[model samples]
Target: MMTDLHVVPARRGRAVRLAKGQAIQIINTHGQQVVDTWCFNADDMSEFMSMEHLHATLQGIFPATGDGLTTNRRRPILILEEDTSPGRHDTVIAACDVHRYAALGCTQYHDNCTDNLRAALGHLDLRTADCPAPLNLWMNIPVSPDGKITWGEPLSKPGDHVTLRAALDCIVVMSTCPQDMIPINGAACTPTEVHYRLIA
Candidate 1:
């Protein structure tokens, strides 16, 4: 099978279709950046990958290798094939949006994941609510004993990546999280790269 590669610019997003037995690799080309990611059943846009369902089924808050990320209907969508980061990917936190930035007081045209996903999936009509919160790759959102979640710089270094195998034909969407207001990207955002290919 031929390999497919796509570059996702900083503060932007990209989308791709994956057949079963295929996998998508997300590269954190520049360190300290986060990629907001989610996917859907290629045959049914309404059936989306759900972080909640994954937690309920896996009995864990964050994903682990060998775990299958599931859809809202509890069907497997993708599997966590490999993780080469420091193991700090986040399942908590919603994708960044204008409203979130507005609440943070920088309301003027800030690049965000919500818009990126919508733009990337141009063929589909999606509302913010329609898109669930994503698997935050390279994002460090740690929960303190007090139960407060804090955003910190990623544990991932440059060139680190994670791969997800499609359990079904799927539509994968991702965004280079454009959050400069916080330290999630170490105060700067950068471009990301994605590679896709068949596994066997």
Candidate 2:
């Protein structure tokens, strides 16, 4: 069974519950918006997806279709079941926060992925003391041989999506990253909404 498409409003976040074996198809509705994604065990929030452990598990950074998304405990929580884009989802960048915006010269508070995750979880009456580094869906950060990283615009076209299948009962949280000072989302430096739906 497939549910109706849902929107993760621009510059905001959304969370969903996924039973074991269920999947979520997240759409890059406008083509270039980066969605910061996180997953936590429904039974134990502390056992959330860990990018560091994932790097060791996969022996690489970018997780493509068929790759197991591992948790802090080094077990599969979700698998990248499908990807319609160029398979450039980033795993190295930390979710943007007020400090990040401030470094970019923001004088006032700005919408951020860190806060977005917190608020999203709050709606579900859940909390996590740590904001684990997210799996940055569609974020294009090119790495050079010298280990330098250059923020590149997304290469995905409108409507491209990735299907992530859960291997454990968990909560999936997504945040349409609100970074506008740089062009990670797109060359336009504009953030936009993305869509998602649950699938059996």
Candidate 3:
């Protein structure tokens, strides 16, 4: 049986935290919102997250149940407990920075993903000097047969969400993407919410 969950809407430039063992549900409240996420060991910031290893363990392009999110040292960070919407997430697209903004014709939004990372790091009393690559969740990015990835349409609707349980003491930093130059976070930037609930 699925449990009834509460929903939260996190606007652009906002940050939220999810404790170990608790579940964090990221919802695209306004449809087609891209949430860039970075996970690190709260106790040790040097130990960062690695997406290449994570994808290898999953044995698929996207994450699903029985898949383990591993760290740089190949340690299991989080297990994919549930994926309400699969085949819609992109682990390859790194977080947008100032350079990307300038290249993408949106230099005005120079402080996109970097700012969000700083906010989340500040909340955890961690330093942002070493911002790691992020995991783009709920964003529709498809790789063509020619081995090229192009930004696709929004995969999530107004209420679509993805849930995951923490496998360790992890510090999750997410940015409800405010990218307006592309259609990843919808044509217009919107808010998203992070809901937490402990499993008994």
For model 1, the stretches where C-alpha displacement exceeds 4 angstroms are 1-4, 123-129, 187-200
Per-candidate local distance difference test: 0.81, 0.96, 0.67
Q: Write the residue-wise lDDT of candidate 1 on 1-200 in tens digits.
A: 44655677777888878889888887777667788999988888888899888889988777888889999999889999998887788888998888999999984878889888889888455434466889888789889889999878888887787889999998888898888777888755444443333444
Model 2 lDDT, residue 122, Cα: 97
Identify the leading candidate in terms of TM-score. 2
Worst ten in a row by lDDT for model 3: 191-200
Winner of 2 and 3 under lDDT: 2
Candidate 3: stretches off by over 4 Å: 1-19, 107-109, 187-200
Clashing pairs in 1: none
Backbone clash numbers for all candidates listed: 0, 0, 4
Alpha-carbon runs more than 4 Å astray in model 2: none
Worst 10 residues of 2 by lDDT: 57-66
Q: How high a TM-score does candidate 1 get?
A: 0.90
